[model samples]
Target: MRRLDLPPVWLLLFALAVLVLSRLDPWSLRLEGAAVDLAAGLLIGGGALLVAVAVVQMRQARTAVLPRREAAHLVTNGVFGRSRNPIYLGFVMLLLGWVLRLGSAPALALVPLYAWVIERRFIRPEEEALARRFPQAFARYREATRRWL
Candidate 1:
């Protein structure tokens, strides 16, 4: 399979879709309560933090940091030390937050579809490349970190 790179455009589009699908129609299911807002904020904050950590780790590794690509070095330290796919994790968190804020059940359904599409289209190819590039190191890292958390 070709490289499974998801460009910024596609990521943004997916994010937008999640937001739209989950948006609360004030007339339907009003989400004006502070509790829901707090939960949404926490989710958004967590997502941002995860993404930031991933970016910092990539910079430290001196790698391209694209989901469709493999790092020149197997980054098994820092944020990578904990999760194999921090960026994806962040996106998933963001999706959950979006759904919470919108109070939409349909939005939750998209979460599985998003995960499946990403795993099949992007993650697998990147893993294969990483294995070829850093076989031993990648294996060790894989053994240590969970693919998703």
Candidate 2:
């Protein structure tokens, strides 16, 4: 299949934006007591864990790598068994975790925008490529696992 045309620079830019948005807002939005802290911790920690898992899976696949520009294989095992786009999910979780940490409604404004760009620019084309490369297996995997958590 033809490789998707996403730029590595854009991914880096988006990541930087997420980091900045998570921390820069003046309003320190706090969640109510233990629940907020717990959820924030979960989102941050889970996001970190998912990133680690994705990294390990990338090493294993020696192919199904990131940025939609460097993909080499159609990975469908390990973390890929659970989520089709663990890296993207990790990123979203990280963003949400940041919003939780910031508790700033404005900071959260970035989440949906991020999701939209990711879904359109990264996810859709990747799905198309996967469908082309491993039509049968990809369909089966799609049936089994979710696109996101």
Candidate 3:
């Protein structure tokens, strides 16, 4: 079987795990408040928006967004200029929103874990490939942008 290096797959797995663990209510903090709900909603919405922007930028650049694929161009504008890995940042935000919605402190731990795994599994290699493909441009972009913002 092909190894699943897709960040979305990992996101889904982590999200499902959070959902299941939240339902279990094991050592969970059930904070019921309108503020919490609003925050969660904002996080989810903002994260989705960021992901959309990143994907659209990549598409416009005619570059491959998938980690396993080769990129056709170096996209260093808009959201890409702000964060080199906006999609991953968006994914983290989505997970954080879910954690807040569930009010599960244990589930909160998954956010960092998700970020670390994504960085090691996808981001690092993709950066290396980007550097190889667009040496000077990638270096400049890397210097100008934060990896996750």
Candidate 4:
């Protein structure tokens, strides 16, 4: 059997797990305000926008978007300028949005869990590779940008 090797695949798996758990919301916690709904909608939209911008920037730079591959260039402009791992940040935002939408306090735990998994599984390794590939530039970029914002 092939290994489930990609970060996105892992993210999707965790998301699915969160979805399943949300169905079993034990405390029955819920936010019953239009403002809460608005916040959730904003998070969903912003997360999607961040992911889209990151992908587009990667494509324009002719760099590999997947963390497993070597990047062709160090992307530090646009969304990349704001967060070193905008894609991963986007994923976290998406999870948060889902948790909010579901109104599940238990599901909120998955957001941090997803972040931990992505950081350990993908971001750290990718950063190591980038440091090796573009030592000076990567150092400067790392110093300038937050990992997640």
Cα lDDT tens digits, model 2, 4-74, are 44433444565567567556756655345677778878988998899788889788778756555546777
- TM-score against truth, every candidate: 0.82, 0.76, 0.94, 0.93
Give the top-scoring candidate (TM-score). Answer: 3
Candidate 1 residue-wise lDDT, 1-149, digit = tens: 23434734445666687677655434364445788789888998998799889988888879978765557787777777788888877877777787777776666677677777777876778888888899998888888889886
Report the lDDT of model 1 for residue 5: 42
Q: After TM-score superposition, what is the CA distance of residue 130 in candidate 3 from its true location, in Å? A: 0.4
- Total clashing pairs for each candidate: 0, 2, 0, 0
Q: Pairs clashing in candidate 4?
A: none
**Highest lDDT among the candidates is held by which one?**
3
After superposition on all C-alphas, the RMSD of every candidate to the true structure, in Å, is: 3.3, 4.2, 1.2, 1.4
lDDT per residue as tens, model 3, 116-145: 999999999999999999999999999989
Candidates arranged by lDDT, highest first? 3, 4, 1, 2
Candidate 4 residue spans exceeding 4 A from truth: 1-3
Candidate 2, superposed: residue stretches over 4 Å from native: 1-32
Per-residue lDDT value at 134 in model 4: 99
